[model samples]
Target: MNSGEVIDVTRDAIVTFLKVGGPMLVVALLVGVAISLLQALTQIQEQTLVFVPKILALAAAALFAMPFMGDAMASYMTRIAERIAGG
Candidate 1:
């Protein structure tokens, strides 16, 4: 593929990746921040305390976002297939 097409595909792939992962990342970040604040207030410096909630938050976010992730990935793959077919 030419440089322009390669760049376009790369950009699309990155955008798709961010869209797919963004929700979970945001959830995890929020959970972490909240946990940190609670820990600060309670003076409980437990690493496990921070981790478990973050895990659960990320899991819930991933589950909630599964359909969106699938659709984004499918659309990206379809575009790739169309490009391949055209070439």
Candidate 2:
């Protein structure tokens, strides 16, 4: 692939990755922020308290988003494969 093509492919790959991970990441971030606020207010500095909820929330988000992520990745792969074959 030429430089432009390579860049396009890389960009697409990154976009695909972000699309797949975005929901889970957002959930984790929101949960973390909320937990941080709660901890601050309560003055409870338990490490597990912060981590466990975020992890569980992220896991749940990932599970719920799995089908959509799979479809997006599959579409991206199909497009990339078609481009490669055409070239």
Question: In order, what is each prediction's RMSD in angstroms?
Answer: 0.8, 1.1
Residue 31's lDDT in candidate 1:
89
Q: What are the runs in model 2 whose C-alpha is more than 4 Å off?
A: none
Residue-by-residue lDDT tens digits, candidate 2, 15-85: 99999988988898899899999999999988889778887888888889999999999999999999989
Model 1 lDDT at residue 77: 99
lDDT tens digits, residue span 1-87, model 1: 999999999999999999998888888888888999999999998878987778777888888899999999999999999999999
Local distance difference test values of all predictions, in order: 0.91, 0.91
TM-score of each: 0.95, 0.91
**Model 2 residue 85 CA deviation in Å:** 1.1
Model 1 regions more than 4 Å off: none
Give the per-residue Cα lDDT of candidate 1 at 27: 89
Model 2 residue 5 distance off true place after TM-score fit, in angstroms: 1.0
Pick out the ten consecutive residues of candidate 1 with the lowest summed lDDT.
50-59
How many clashes in each structure? 0, 0
